[model samples]
Target: MFVSRLLDFQKTRYARFMNHRVPSNCRYQPTEYEHAANCATHAFWILPSILGSSILYILSDDQWETISAWIYGFGLSSLFIVSTIFHTISWKKRHLRTVEHCLHMFDRMVIYFFIAASYAPWLNLRELGPWASHMRWIIWIMASVGTVYVFFFHERSFGGRDAGAGMREQGRAAMTCFFHMVAPNGKQKAPGVSPKPQTPDSELAAPRPG
Candidate 1:
């Protein structure tokens, strides 16, 4: 009877703790069965890109272009690899929980590297035009700054300190510009028209003035 009451007390305490607010990073979902599954899922997603891109990069006739391609491919791939490894390292062993938390921060650090790597190649590409040289220097500088900022931010954020006023803002504008440049119809189609301008359905239904 005493044991049952103690068990109930423990359960109640756990329930209360879980119901209480916790930081997102602290609330990791690496509970048992999902640990290996998380790793496997990410591995399967990343491995093919790594293998296929590596082969393509090796065979590309223009080594110069391939360099940039490889950078883009590998930067994103490494994140998957790092995340897979971090998640795979379960904290069920109790002693490893501290290590797992450390790895979580390490994973965030890699994100900074990946973000930088993704843009580093575009800096050297001649096709990017006159501003390419200038943007390259700017990107590298911001990346360096963002990396340091993000690493420290994640550390404090994980420690339950909400001091992330400007967590990893550097290089973001450049990255956004790069993405827009690559996207279809990145420019304004016409003044006052949306990027994906669709004429009114009513106009289509009615006879054209022309």
Candidate 2:
């Protein structure tokens, strides 16, 4: 039957894609199926994320709100956009080591900005007491420091394996602080107003060893 022939063809293609060997210089290389899935997952969300951010920006009632909206929107869109491009390149142009390496670093860097942006609306809009008020500036400073660290010391200071664990711990600590401040009274404050933190699955996608 035609359906049987189609299934056999698919199996052949899958085997061919999966049989490719990981390059020696790369820490990890995804199978073709993984590359395609990662690219699709992030690409699919790009437009919706942008549209949602635009809606939030339009709904803002004041200057501070508008600024927060803009920050959050840019962060949200860039996260998806950069992720999609990176994965697409990874899948389609794996041979371009230099270009892939640069994008891989950039992809990692965007997560810090996204974290700060996720908290922007809440930190700017709510009153979290005098001590907590400083968190608004503190979060950004932390993000900036994180960016610099990723740029200069990511895989350089520690070997590739440990560096990832350290980055994850740092991200976890940052989120923990954000949640603690957001809910000092032990109740969710903003409900639908504040965007929930996002962890892109592509964050774990393998990068070439530099």
Model 2, position 151, has a per-residue lDDT of: 76
Give Cα-based local distance difference scores for all models: 0.60, 0.74
Stretches of candidate 1 above 4 Å error? Answer: 1-37, 91-94, 129-132, 157-171, 179-210
What is the total number of backbone clashes in candidate 2?
0
For model 1, the run of ten residues with the poorest summed lDDT: 185-194
Per-candidate Cα RMSD to the true structure, in Å, reads 11.0, 16.6
Pairs that collide, model 1? none
Query: Which candidate achieves the best lDDT against the true structure?
Result: 2
What local lDDT does model 2 show for residue 171? Answer: 55
**lDDT score, candidate 2:** 0.74
TM-score of each predicted structure versus truth: 0.57, 0.68
